[model samples]
Target: MADTARRTDDLLAGLPVPGARSPGQGERAAGAKNTARAARSRFMAAHGEEVYDRLTDGRTRHLRLRELVDAAAREFPGLVPDAAQLAQESARPQADKDGREIDQGIFFSRLLGSPLAGPHLMDAMLRPTDRALRLLPDFRRTGFADLGSVTLERRGSAAHLTMCRPDCLNAEDNEQVEAMETAVDLALLDPAVHVGLLRGGEMTHPRYRGRRVFSAGINLKSLHAGRISLVDFLLRRELGYIAKLMRGVLVDHETSWQSRTIEKPWVAAVDTFAIGGGMQLLMVFDRVIAGSDAYLSLPAAQEGIVPGAGNFRLGRLAGGRISRQVVLWGRRLWASEPDARLLIDEVVDPAAVGAAADAALERLDSPAVVTNRRVLNLAEEPPEAFRAYLAEFSLQQALRLYSEDVIGKVGRFSAGCAAPPA
Candidate 1:
């Protein structure tokens, strides 16, 4: 009987039980392992002592015992854990969520203590919606080593270029000019970009730092010294090249159209004297926002040279009488000139110039319309001559001659006609 009992015990130990299986038995062992893992998982999830100990510290994301209980109730159906139990388990103290703290300060006392509390409390406890703040000109990461001390930022769809080069009003060296031009061209080429804001290349005013001034002109010292200069030949070449490039963009069969895949309107706020080449670029823009502290001049005549590209274009835009005075005499026109036709559009206060540009931009809805109209009107008179020139000189021939000859002739003839008969 004892031998039989011993044999029966041996059989029970060797054979698989209801919940247990031998590890050496592959398929059965895997099933057993899975069951063991599931049981361990349930136990761990219920206690989670190891997880809590590993993850939490004194500074860990701690919630109030009551809040935890409430949250648990929300997550688990009909299972609201005890707040006191949670408080005992989790030693971390809880005051309130940051948002709730704001609400408490705003409306907690009033609600708890007043008759007017209930109705107003809900409203007061509400927080204002938060919005993402972004850097303007979106140029936060942009850095230019050769740009001297100028820093540019984005303002809406425009790139705002500011010269932070001390109060010396040092004229633009080649490095500075190249940097500015490259940066401007980069921003201009971008389809998303619209306008550029230029500021502080000059002092506001030497006597009054707040008053504002502009850089005198291209650094003549650098120019004459030949260290880095704006020589006439180089200037003419560069100017013609840039103007031609701009005309291509502005008059392209595709880009010229406002609805094209790529197109933009440009404007600049001249804070001070945009003299020489700097002033020349301003004419290329659709508009100029002249600061009250600003002055516009053409100083090539003063330098015993012609403004060339600048003078020719200015003459077209401003008419001969005014253009001659501006270029030949180098007259400094203030931003508030009531009769200044050359400036284009309105003369506004410096502070209001930005707003004015925006208002003007709103009015010019279609760049295509503007370009086409100007092209047609410029091509209207001297059609045969323009066509002949167009065959040789192309569109530029018309733009230049129309101003020099057409306007000049028309003005002379009109004056002759209006004069008293001899």
Candidate 2:
């Protein structure tokens, strides 16, 4: 571990300092840009392949991957922009798009794009988070885990994993993502549960007061506040809980060929709306039940970021044109609409959502549900394809997260000038 840490420190040290200016007069700015470019090239030449090899060496554990990231942040402060810096950057009228941390994004983009690192990264992410591991034993015994932003309660044959950020309409943030994934781990690992049900808790937001909302997607407030991290929130999310929702929990560290996973059919009950990430999640569920008055939309264009795996999976569920309409054109599909039926398995009265979910969960708890779901997943996504999509997504999303457009959009949304994407 000491040797590895030393080597890692050396590799990180080679990276260009974010705003280092070459010492001189008049031509200092241009000279700094040129110097930074040279430094980057030198680092890539010396350490790029080594970094890939290290990532795919198959010896480093998931915890070690996190340790390395933490080390990078500690050793090179601005390299991995902490939460406070991220918040500061988000609130700026014009963000520092080419800031020091942008290089960190570039590093991850290249790293994730590697054929070796791509799948390895997927494997690492699929392993349950440490928080899940810590809480699992208690949850397994009690069949109930109340993770602050989300909760897991095993009810009969179904494990109800409720997203509970009522104040934010269950919008996903790092803490929520961690909690949700941990709850998902509990649900999948519990032997008594045959089906997993996802639903949002009641909201405190005035417009949706006392009402349950499926999700408002990424917390725009958090994003505008710079509380979101490129790796921890963006990459970890799609690759972590959301992917776990589709693929299942990795139970053993065997090769992908002989891997063991604990998986169950999942049912999503959409109450008020499934916006952005919420809508993206529906693509992975085995069954979806929505209130007739509910709606769905992927406002990726409006938000100026990729809507998780929506691009890869939405087309598979709703076909090309409609997928394009929702993802690219900002089209919202109400549950009653014909197009909505493509994504929603059942649309019932708002009051009937619970009953509808119960029925779906009952049906999903059958002996063949897991087998058939696995077959369907293999036919449609296959782990390899999903892994590749996320590899590219990590890079594209990192860039977008720091882009001026996203910062501006988030700023407007934060200021209450921009309405939620319809």
Candidate 3:
């Protein structure tokens, strides 16, 4: 996001150092060389040293950082990491874990410089394959006012994303969306994570008491209060990490190029309800295990704005006609119905949904799962066609955001809420 402003090398050099050798001394060069050797030693021990040396041989090690990043882009895509996960994993090498390339993209920036840094990081982060993404250093949300809405925990070969805005039935605002986006990005990049589980905060908030509700959709209170801007909404949904993606793209891509579907399977455990934006997200989940009494609906018609990307993805799950009713006519989909059950893979007791999701994901943890997912994605939702639909959806959504109907809806929806959030 830095706009090529300052010369990074000069900036790093000009900064005052404590107890350091004088400028232009070979000491710094020796230090950098030592770092390079350490990286080589680790890579070699892990069976990738030859690949590293071949790519970096005779070249200045710092200058060669780009080649590793580019290799990850070409060969591993979304798995090329930025920071937090790598830092955590590397910090405890004595702990058992899978081996991977030097995952920190900034290692290159610190050594080679920013001009070389920015583009490679961008490219590595933007790849659509399962491994395609770069986390910010410390790897939290990028453009949000708060990060309390979503939390991530890395488990062995799994990442758990917990949505925690239970005060609004776990409703989403720009902050929540941004936080969830980073959570998903972390799961995609971490080689240790082969599965992801998403669920709600439940008893985490006082207003909800002890009840568990998956989500109430977009935070109408936030939208009405002007807490979320039209630009933030559009950019995040259209181009940011949580953009509508074809599950099939992930499933069908080569091991190297697999998109989200093939990248890592995500299981959604819906406890109470999924409405509008919340219901819409199930379209991208590899598996959905919802409570028996849970309900799903796309109430965009009532909202007077598009329900996130629900309109585009709903039809693939619930047929065009059913989707139309939910999206256009405001139909509440109950988990008990055959139609609702069609979209959700399993229906379980509300309290057991998490266990059900874990069991389902465990069954899917196989070497061929990605290939199998790709096959399903290709057969069901081709990427090209889905992208075309998104293009149209985005256009209509932009117009809807600032429309008169939406302005009226905001007033009415806000009136029905508790109060403007503190």
Please provide, for model 2 over 48-143, each residue's C-alpha lDDT reduced to its tens digit, 9 standing for 90 to 100. Answer: 547555544543654323454554455444334445544545554334323434445555655556566656666777787778888878887888
lDDT of 1 by residue, 1-422 (tens): 22332333344335453224344543543344334334433433453333222222321423321232244334432222224433332232111100111111111122212222222221121111111012212333442222455555555566556655444353555555544544554444444455455545435334535644344454444333323322112232232223322332221244334422123455556665556655766665666677665667776555443343565467667778877787777676656675354663566676776677666555544557446534643453222332222122211221222222332332332321121111
Q: Model 2 Cα displacement at 59 (Å)?
A: 3.2
The C-alpha TM-scores of every prediction are: 0.46, 0.83, 0.62
User: Per the 3 Å backbone cut-off, how many clashing residue pairs does candidate 1 have?
Assistant: 7
lDDT scores in order: 0.41, 0.74, 0.57
Please state every model's RMSD to the true fold in angstroms.
31.9, 5.6, 16.6
Q: Compared with the true structure, what per-residue lDDT tens digits does model 3 show for residues 317-384?
A: 77899988888898888898988976799998877888898897787766687667657867876544
- The alpha-carbon deviation from the true structure for residue 304 of candidate 2, after best TM-score superposition, in angstroms, is 1.2
Ranking by TM-score: 2, 3, 1
Residue 122 displacement in candidate 1 (angstroms): 68
Cα lDDT of candidate 1 equals 0.41
Query: What C-alpha lDDT, on a 0 to 100 scale, does residue 137 get in candidate 3?
Result: 35
